[model samples]
Target: MTQTTILPIDALFSRVEAIFLKAGLNAVQAGALARVIVAGERDACKSHGIYRIEGALRTVKAGKVKPDAVPVLDRNEGSAIVKVNAGGGFANPAFELGVPELAARARKLGIAALVINDCTHFSALWPEVEAVTNEGLAGLVMCPSYATVAPTGGNKPLLGTNPFAFGWPRKDTSPYVFDFATSVAARGEIELHRRAGKQLPEGWAIDADGNPTTDPEAALAGAMLPFGGHKGSAIGTMIELLAGIMIGDLTSPEVLDYLGTTTLAPFHGELIIAMSPEAFAKGRPGDPFARAEVLFEAIVGAGARLPSQRRFAARKKSEAEGVSLTAAEIEQLDRLLDKGLDAIA
Candidate 1:
C-alpha cells in the first residue's frame, strides 16, 4: 500500500542524523553522512539514499565498515598525484574528502590522479561533481565497486558496473552532468527490483553461462552486461584501471568472485580530473553560459530532457509534497525507530 507523509528536508536530515547517531555513529560523523545520503534521496536517488543506511548499519555492526573513520591525505609535491587512506572501509565518511582533493590537484597540473584505499562508499557522484563545478572546473569522476559485471565475451562476474560521471560548467545553464554506471543497468536498480519482487528488465544481465536473464535472482547470481556491449566493456575496463588497478585494489579476475559483496574493500577506487574552463573558452567565447542555455533550451524545449532532469524534477515534487513511502517501508522504519523505550537516541 502507498502512504503519504510530509517531512521538511531539514527535518528529514535531522531524523536521519539522529537515527545514525543512535546506531553508534559519532555526532559529527552521523551528521556528515546524513547530509550526503539525504541529498541523494532528495534528488530522487533512492539507490544511494536512506535505503543504503540499513546496509551501512549492518556493515558497521558486522565490523566491516567503521562509523567514524577520518581520511588521511597522501600527496606528492608537484606531482598531481595523491592517495587517501580511508580508515574503516567502504560506507565510511573519509572517501568524500579524497574526491575534491584529487580534483584540485588535477587542476594544478592539467591532470591529477588520486586513489581512495579502504574508504567507505561515497554515494552518487553527482553531489561530488557539484563540488568541483563550484570550483569553476570541468570534472570527470570514475568510481568503482566490487565486481558485479562480466567482460564482453565472458561470464562469472569479472568487474563492477562502475559508474562514470562527468561535469562541465556552463556560464548560463546548469552544469552538464553525465552520470551512468558502465552496466546496462546499475546493480542497485536490480537489487531494488528484487526487493520489490519485480523481474529484471531485458538485456540487463546475463546468467552464469553468459546468457541474458530477466530473473532478478539469477541475475544476482550471474553478471551484469555492459551498457553498449564492447564499448561499455571498454569503458568499464578503463574505470577499473583508474579506480582499481591504479589504487592497488582488486584487479581483473580477483573481482570476479567478490564483486557486489561488502566483505571486500569496496572502497576500492575513485579517480577525478578537473580542468579549468578558461583553458577551453580562452578566446571568442560567446558567454559559455548563454551558449549552454540556448543549447539546453533547444533540446529540452524540443522534447529532449537531460539525463538527471527526471530525478531532479521528482525531487522537487517530493520536496513540495513530502516523500511518498509505501506502507511497508514506513512500518519497517517505525518498528526500527520504536525498538525499546530508549529509542529516542
Candidate 2:
C-alpha cells in the first residue's frame, strides 16, 4: 500500500459524501452524514471518524440501509416523536430529523424526549447534542445496542456497550457535552484497535471466559466490560430498557433476524431530550447562547475543557491542514472505493 497525505477536511468531506451519493443518498442526507463524520473527527473520536466509511458502505451494499429513506415524524398532544425507517439508510438523518422538532418541542413543553427506531448506525451523539446546545437548549441522548458485552460478572454476552450522551447549556461557557459508551470503551474502538493489531488498555475487555484480556482480537471474540463496574452496568441496563423494551425495537433480536446468525451489529436505540432554559433561567439570561459562551470561557479557565475538546481541536487542525492518514488506512480506503466502484459496475 502506497502512503499518501490525508485529504483536506473539505476534500475529505466531499470524498466521503461522494461515496454515499454513489450508494444513492440525496445531497442533503449526504451532507448531514458528512457533518457528523467531520464533527466526530473534530472532537477526536477517531473510531467514529473515517474508519467507519467502509463498514457503513458495506451495510449499504447489503441492502440493509436505504440511501434515500427520510424520517417521518408523528405529532401528538404535548409531545412529538418520529419513527425513522431509514429503510436501512444512514443513522444520522434519522437522528437529525429530531433536531428541529426537539427544539420546537422544548419551546412548548419546556422539555421534549424523542425516540428513534429502525435507524442505521448513528455515529457520535456529541454533534447532535452540540446542535441543540448551539440552539440554546440542553439536550441529552442515549442509544442502546445489541449484546456485545458480558454483564459485569456473567460469562454470556447479554448487553450492548450502550452509550449515553448529554449536552447541557451553561451560562458563559461551552455547553457541557458528555458522550461515552457504558462500556469501558466503545466497540468501534475495539474494532479499530484490532485492525491495527494493537492491545487494549487495562481493564477494558474480557475474554470469552470473562477474564480481562489486552488482546483486541480476543476482546472482539469475547466481550467488553462496562465502565464503573456494577454502577455503569446498571446504567447500561437502564438504557436497554429505555431504548429496547420501551421502543419495542430490541437490538439483539434484530441483529439475529438481520444477520441470519447471532453475530452482533451495532444497531442503536436512541433517545434525545431537549430542555429549554426559559423554565430554569426565568428570562434573566435572555440569550442562552451568550450564556453558553460565558460558561465555556469560565470552564476552560478553570482547567476544564469541554468533553471531546481534544477531538475538536484535532479536527480544526486537520481541516486547516489535512486529515491524518496512515499508509495502511489510505490503502484500505482505496480498496473500499474500488469495491464500491465494482458494485456499480
Regions more than 4 Å wrong, model 2? 1-8, 42-44, 80-85, 170-174, 188-202, 211-218, 253-257, 260-265, 283-305, 318-345
Clashes per candidate (backbone, < 3 Å): 8, 20
Question: Model 2, 186: alpha-carbon shift in Å?
Answer: 2.7
TM-score, every prediction: 0.83, 0.81
Which candidate leads in TM-score? 1
Query: Model 1 RMSD to the real structure?
Result: 3.8
Error of 2 at 320 (Å): 4.6
Tens digit per residue, CA lDDT, model 1, 1-345: 356566677877887787777777775568767887788778777777777667666656655567766667787676777777766554335545566676677566656666667655656778766667767777888867767789788876877778899887765435778888888987778888999999987988998778889988899888888889899999999987877787776564554344445333354556667777565565865866567678888998899887777666877777787766566656655654555213322
> Candidate 1, after superposition: displacement of residue 84 in Å?
2.7
